[model samples]
Target: MTERLMNTLETPCLIIDAQRMDRNIQVMADMARNHQVNLRPHAKTHKIPAIALQQIEAGAVGITVAKIAEAEVMAAHGIRDIFIAYPLVTASKIERAIRLSQRIELIVGVDSLAGAQLLEQIAGRHGHSLQVRLEIDTGLRRTGVLYDQAAALAAEIAGMPHLRLTGIYTFRGSLLAGKPTLDIAAAGKEEGTLMVQLAERLRAQGIAISDVSVGSTPTAAYAAAVEGVTEVRPGTYVFHDRMQARLGACDLEDCAGSVLVTVVSRPSAELAIVDGGSKTFATDIQPGTEPLQLRGFGHILELEDATLARLTEEHGMIELGPQAQAANLRIGDKLRIIPNHICSTVNLHNHVVMQRDQAYKRLPVLARGMLE
Candidate 1:
């Protein structure tokens, strides 16, 4: 019989079951391969180089990072292909980008002519050409140039010396919340279609838009169906969070990452305190028009069905549900918590403990707190 793995961890530690993680990785890889789309998982979900290597070895084309420092870290770990999926500007930053290009294939997102020009100058000075993706504001409205202006921006990026306009990218994270009945798949398809239309318009204007990347765990399933999208960059699909769960992207059992906490005190009949707090969990609430008011930082996993009842910063309060609470839970009893946002929660810890049955090992979060 296989030994239970949770018995070995200390409180307030992030524990990842290796088997579960491999399954998640394989599921996404198979999905992308079967659908004929490139899998470039966002490394921001788990900054560990070992995990990133596992993803690459499992058939991911490359890795995605949100910051220059993260790219630097991954590059040090020998990850040769990286996509910085955020709009970047600044002489110093562009210089760093140019240097990174020398070490690995680098792709940065650009939404404005000014940003593109800066990158162009840096690349020119370094005697290097850089790959860039024009971001389109496809209803998300957080970043990217206006969809109508995408062609113009592409033209500018294409005209710049030492800079190549690779394609376009967008985040459908905005669609993850709202009435559970909302069809995010349809919204994702529409967003992708709009991006493809813009890319086609750019091509008509004599600009070569070679790649179109669209992603969000909620919409990745349908994103692959978008006619013109060449690659899907869904990060959270590897470790489904509470938001992903609510969006119907993954069942609770599919969540591979959780915070291990020990019950410290039962302050009141309605309140119980755990060792994990904001320091362990993250402050990022769910995304939507009326976001789910997550009461605490993270949710307590009810073992029977992996349901979470309530959350607080330092304490995860459980509302006794139909299934009896595990009688094994007592003072000092360790419980696993499914975080609201796996990416941010993972960012909080410097290391993650990997468990397989009765054996446990530690892996450095290698790129933790690399916010630059």
Candidate 2:
């Protein structure tokens, strides 16, 4: 950002570098293209319709969202092709999905016969054939069905009166077996291989499996390389975070979104407090986590010798290292902090400041808190 523009901003702000973000988007798009896999970047990361459209224009086939409400928000903003990556169980939610499917190219996820049956009953009554992707448990162990039961469940879902099982997907971060590992390529390749093999098995049984989608930002690149995989949905690449940088997904310079805050207080030579805290940054990607071993709430760009050691509702405690103590920092100094998890941090804000060259614009976080 230009210094003149920077002086006009308020403290505890969310700023997105448009040029860097566009580069990040294109890089992911190019990766998918080179591997011949569809790039369906997840919209859950930014939750901004403008950003989603930017990704689509860059090369994304569509956008993937974690909730139907988010899909609705995206669709409202002229996003036609969407995948509800999560399973919708309630009748009202399925009804919403059915309504959404009527207007655009909609695909929902199904991991069980029960979920699939509910969709079938509702869609059948509505006289609509709802398209779905079978979510198989490749090892994330969250919402997907077990690998052993995938074939049976998929077969059951494929036979449903109003449901069409056209694809299978799994979301496993950089993990091997069930444990996190630094070997992202191996984990990604494994994810793609598992999904592709499962798709082949289902196809052999005349199930007409078409899309074998897999991957998050950490795994999208390698997974897309696997021959039979049809699509990859990587969310965090749009604004690479500290966690992604540690995971080797991107360099720290690649991080495009950051919290801009002013030094609020200086309690001691080693302790400088910022205007942003838990209310400004995400707390989910906590410090001292395994695998990555992230040490702080965020990475301070200007002060590499300072750590965002703690945060309350509106106070960020920056523990200045020995190198930082000699710098003689003062109050009212602005600092840009790259949060550990930009996606969650984004949910806490109503709008983000987009910067390109010296120009700036405020974009609403339209899909924020659309958890339902």
Candidate 3:
């Protein structure tokens, strides 16, 4: 008989600490409450419905996702309140989004007049309106309309019969990068200030704003405290990753997810190869205010100075620094790795072997590959 379930399981699998995850969820929920804002954490982090329910039970007002397919997955699992924190432009996606709205309290992110028009067309065909939060560009400069341009767009969107301009949101991803004197409260304050200013601009034009949302796990803790930030959409706080630890979003012990891999080769004194590779880990570098040109793709928990230096499709190359060499790892020895990006890392896996009270069980990544 197998000595234990873990011993019989394959390497290169995803493992999550259930207690750590619960604490992370509770803390974020409490933080949002203390800040007097609703916690609508992004679901793209774990993509697991059980965790989503855990968050709701912990006081999260709703769940947020990056795609309509993710929302569909959540709805199938009976997750009724969802915010698609991404812009939907394609017709097929719009049609699907409309159908999803029929079954849940759905809110989507919109940035452009063209996107608004497209949503309008979808609503016209479906005979129902789509609720949207205007995405505001607050410095990280990825998506969303310019802050100055929001008022006019709000006015334009309000004219569309099939669309309802619900509120405004922004992503200050740079704030997650730790500063020597990181004032998380201040970051949240600024984000709240920016979003509220834009929301007020819309309200001045008679737009009834209800959801003033700001996001990214780095600022979620503090963003909720902002005077007008109605909700926070932090995703990665559910499964704290190395990036979150390095950014000071959470302590290293708070990271709940890791990739379990077995050492497969020791070809050199400076490097070791592992069964896990790029396909198993994520290549996303840490994002924040400071340029975290992080040196490695992932960090090995067992080897203090070992960096998952590089990864190909099927193999990971670990470069051993002086301290890492002390571990003296051998072939067949297994270790855990904290990936740089937890959200993308989870997407690469089909399941997570979760540990609770020292017992392990599995949970499906139901939303994985839901790219539609």
Candidate 4:
């Protein structure tokens, strides 16, 4: 599409290049097949069920979500297989979990024996059983039981009445970004090795661990090839963001999603503001991995060598760097910005504009903000 046509569209809106997204989906799916791992692309990034179906149609076995509300949305949209990769321990969420199980194949993540017991009790009351995967904290230090302590928890959950221990999983998202000097591939290999060792130990303890999953867009491309890993749950590969590019996961051209904003003002020779702000672009900073430094909130595609200084609720401050005299940007000039975090930025928009074959179409973000 031409700049003229893009400018005619509304500002503070999202635009997705369909061709680029299709290519991204195919690339990740093929990577999984080559490594003999099943692909379960996470739906949390692009909560639209249609995109999940597109993934399923492209050799993905299922979809992964982060919350019960997200899983319920997928089930309502006819998605049958789902993995809620979150430690769901609250009582209110358990009732909704039961409802989702009745409608589809649901696999949940749990890090505690108490959480498993709570789910087991509810499943028993509904005359249902829950397929659960124990979350192992490889190194992120966020959620999940420690890797060494997983076997004991696995044994306890496997012996429970209504909850079955189907597998072990981990989300080492923090390790995906590699600095120019760091070895990212080695990190992925280490993660796979840790996961495989834990799975082997559980098998020896008489727990039939079938699935061993690991994920994150930065490491996902190479993680599938790891032995003993049955599945991968990468969410952001569908819409490569600036962070992915900064971390060496994808190139700028491969990023399909961008926040289209019009130049509202050129307050100074070096600074220009846009209609999109923190509310639109989100304030998520790129991962601070050593050797790979990202200096701004986002990158302006049209403004070569420009920096996004900061963003307020209604304004995106763009400070033209030393090269501004070269790229030459002016007021009323529309631009596309690749946000630091695509998932959070996507949730802020009600809909997105898709570009296919030089045409544009609007699609509602059906599952946006389904936080319940």
* Alpha-carbon TM-score of each model against the true structure: 0.91, 0.98, 0.92, 0.95
lDDT for residue 217 in candidate 4, whole number 0-100: 83
Q: Per-residue lDDT of 231-342 in model 3, one digit per residue for the tens?
A: 8888999889887787788887899998888889999888889999878997666323244555588767857788877789989999999887787888987888888888
Candidate 1 Cα outliers beyond 4 Å, as residue runs = 1-5, 174-181, 286-297, 303-313, 317-329
RMSD of every prediction: 2.9, 1.1, 2.9, 2.0
Flag the better candidate by TM-score, 1 or 2. Answer: 2
For model 4, the stretches where C-alpha displacement exceeds 4 angstroms are: 174-182, 286-291, 326-328
Candidate 2 lDDT, 36-90, residue by residue in tens? 9999999988999999999999999999999999999999999999999999999
Top-down TM-score ranking? 2, 4, 3, 1
lDDT of 4 by residue, 35-101 (tens): 8899999988888998999999999999999989988888899899999999888878987888888
Worst 10 residues of 3 by lDDT: 174-183
Once fitted onto the true fold, the runs of candidate 3 whose alpha carbons sit more than 4 angstroms away are 1-6, 175-186, 286-290
Show model 2 residue runs off by greater than 4 Å.
175-177
**Model 4 backbone overlap count:** 0
Model 2 scores worst on lDDT over the 10 consecutive residues at: 173-182
Q: What lDDT is reached at residue 306 by model 2? A: 92
lDDT of 2: 0.92
Instruction: Say which candidate scores most in lDDT.
Output: 2
RMSD of 3: 2.9
